[model samples]
Target chain A: MSTAQRRLDIEEVGDVTVARFIDKKILDETNIQIIGNQMFGLVDEDGRKRIVLDFTNVEYLSSAALGKLITMDKKVKAAKGKLRLCCIRPEIYEVFEITRLNKIFDIKKTQEEALEGF
Target chain B: MRAGLVEVGSLVPFQLKRWDPQPCGEPRRPAEPEKSPLEFAQEMTDREQFEIFIPSETAAGQAVQDRIIQRLEARGFTDRDVFGIRLSLEEALVNAIKHGNGMDPSKSVRVCCQIDTETVVVEIEDEGDGFQPEEVPDPTAEENLERPCGRGIMLMRAFMTRVEYSDHGKCVTLEKRRSVEGE
Candidate 1:
């Protein structure tokens, strides 16, 4: 329902909501939906469109999770806000590379880098 | 009048009766043993194969993918190979459950995995009406870059060396050759 109730660990930095994925593996369909909903809630319900997704703790994620990221990116942009992703593991970053999502999203090396100018 | 065992290759054939129940008077033979498609596929492989059937419910695809990844890892696959297999298998299962079965809890998705010395093959099948894989838009295309859907099939093709669809697109088979170092 709410972003706080979901598995994602959300924190606010300035006008941006930095959400950290706490799950080791975010491959399951249910977890994908939960995380997606949490991100969507931030943009739609809470009206906090500027966001940062931290993937430092995530070990693995499915293509469905990638799809969710794309969705969130579009949603945040449509709301006149920005969404940045940072701290993605190398292996996980390969998925984005393969899908060419790295070019579509604003991915940075760290949270501070992603938060800058956001 | 007499019954005799007819061995067909390694399969044990049923004894046929000469007595005919139909107008054709053909020898009454037991129906061929029904073999699941997965069983037939496994029979063709010389190494061990793994398979599981899961409902088209939330998170079921991930559970199956996790089990498959574990098996691949134990078989001495490299991390990159295992990661590719895991990602491809997850995409296939998700497609089977979401696109093929439409996330209907009553429907089920079947996954069969076989690992040989050279390659790992996985087949995923669903119960719903199939779709045309060719019609899926390219996610990498500039026009479609922001689209959330249509990326699963692309990722599956990217991660696996070979990807094929059959049974009217209801079934997808993914194959990844094990790295030379893994062998």
Candidate 2:
């Protein structure tokens, strides 16, 4: 899921939304509380919830981790917001490839370009 | 669940198994059941058990997968079945890496794939405190918005019929049913 570990900074350029999460994963279950609120209470002033995930330090990904992404993407889509991922390791890329998830998410080569695109 | 618990994807018979059975005076059979590398496996990573040890890396996992696939191929496993088995094995190793060892390369995970006439069993053990099932976030739920995790269990459960957590939560034993229609 999107760790409270480091939402680093979030700002929207045009219709794009960008946020960086640093050293999450082990932040414990406390993030569940923070994430639950975002689906509704955390809506932006413009009312669109497009989120671009930047994973620079995150190394490994479990299915559980991927599952959370799916759940969040659902919320964003339901609210007419686009959820995308940027800055992922090649190893993690293999996971998406094996599961054919690469076709499912908006995976970008770089965070800057991803943010700029949205 | 009963039949699905032990599904076998492909059914390739063993052709490469070293055939040296004509030695040592009729091959003295062990009086008891032959024990595998590790006896008891962990239920979950949390209360995970100690089992067979193997390097915790991508290649190591692949090698084990190849061996299993080879053996199954020899036994006449269809290509589709083999792919299913591969998916099961991949999930097991992945679970070991994430839940069992917390994705620490320094640590090694244990794997045991036991096959019999009626069923095929796969076990994966990792080195970590293990986690509880309740700890898993529900991806299908709306509350887990924008998060990533918990899909492995769903995929594995979908690929294989029966998946069990042992060693508290460190190890997982996955069993798929075999089709009686011999190829």
Candidate 3:
């Protein structure tokens, strides 16, 4: 359940844990589980609440990944933490828009923008 | 030694040179070969269909999406169309493996993808007793927005031009039209 072995680049910036997904295609269940477990570890184990996911490199993701994001969002909210996403490619963002998840998550144009409010 | 020609249906004739003796008391019947998913695929001049059988496990859906995208791109599909196809295909495959097949690795999800110039069609069938798609709650509803279970079907319907389910909800067919610029 440790985030250390995940395929995400994790960095701490002013109490905000910014995790950038390194994979271009997060389209499967395994990757989704990995991200979900890692994010859960960050919240439950590490107790780091404020998090930003940088999707600059992610070109595509399946609904399974979206489901994981929703789980993460709910966990963070339950713990009084914040979860935001930034740098989503338009194609991937369209999936969010179609499913109306764009309204649920605090999506920003850049990682700096996401970090600003935290 | 005996030699004979065995012709099975439309398949090529098999020349049997010699028959080996059974190792045990009674002759053991040969186990039936499992039918491949590709055997279900239909080929046409205008469109080509590919069927793959994948285990009900994590990350298996991604491989189906990749192959469909490659075919779509090769057929001159736009990036927008490819994106839509990928998203819808992923959703269908996930539903087949997780919801339909219950993530049992012993169960195999069958996927058939047919592509041509104007549209891409995909069908995913699973081994589980299917549920009614109409019964799935609306994810866009305010109360349901936070819920995660029903959004995959919504995404597939939203992205695909048409979505149909048959075989008591065990099979879903999705279709998406190719996007042309300036239209």
Which of 2 and 3 is the better model by lDDT?
3
Ranking by lDDT: 3, 1, 2
Cα interface RMSD of each candidate: 1.6, 8.0, 1.7
Native-referenced DockQ of model 1: 0.52
Give one digit per residue, the lDDT tens place, for model 2 in B28-57: 555445543132111111121112567766
lDDT by residue (A1-118, candidate 2, tens digit) is 3443433456666766666554433122234334434433334434668778777666544454555556666777888877778888775676666555676689987887787757
Evaluate model 2 with DockQ and give the value: 0.17
True contacts kept of each: 0.71, 0.35, 0.71
* lDDT per residue (tens digit) for residues A10-115 in model 1: 8988878899988887786777887788778888888987789999898888877887888888888898898889999888898899888899988999999998
TM-score (all chains, Cα) for each model: 0.78, 0.45, 0.80
By TM-score, the candidates rank as: 3, 1, 2
Off by over 4 Å in 1: A2-5, B1-46, B181-183
Model 2, CA-based lDDT: 0.59
Tens digits of per-residue lDDT for model 3, B1-183: 012111121112211211212222556777446634233221223455666799897577777777788888888887777777787787788888888999987899988766756777777889999999899888888898888767888878777888888878998888888878755
Q: Across residues B24-103, which tens digit of lDDT does each residue of candidate 1 receive? A: 34465664579764554444343556567899964777777777788778778888888778777777887788788999
lDDT tens digits, residue span A1-118, model 3:
5435668789999889998988888877777777778767888888988999999899888777887888889999999989999999888888889888999999999988999968
Worst 10 residues of 1 chain B by lDDT: B1-10
Which has the greatest TM-score? 3
Sum up the clashes in candidate 2: 61
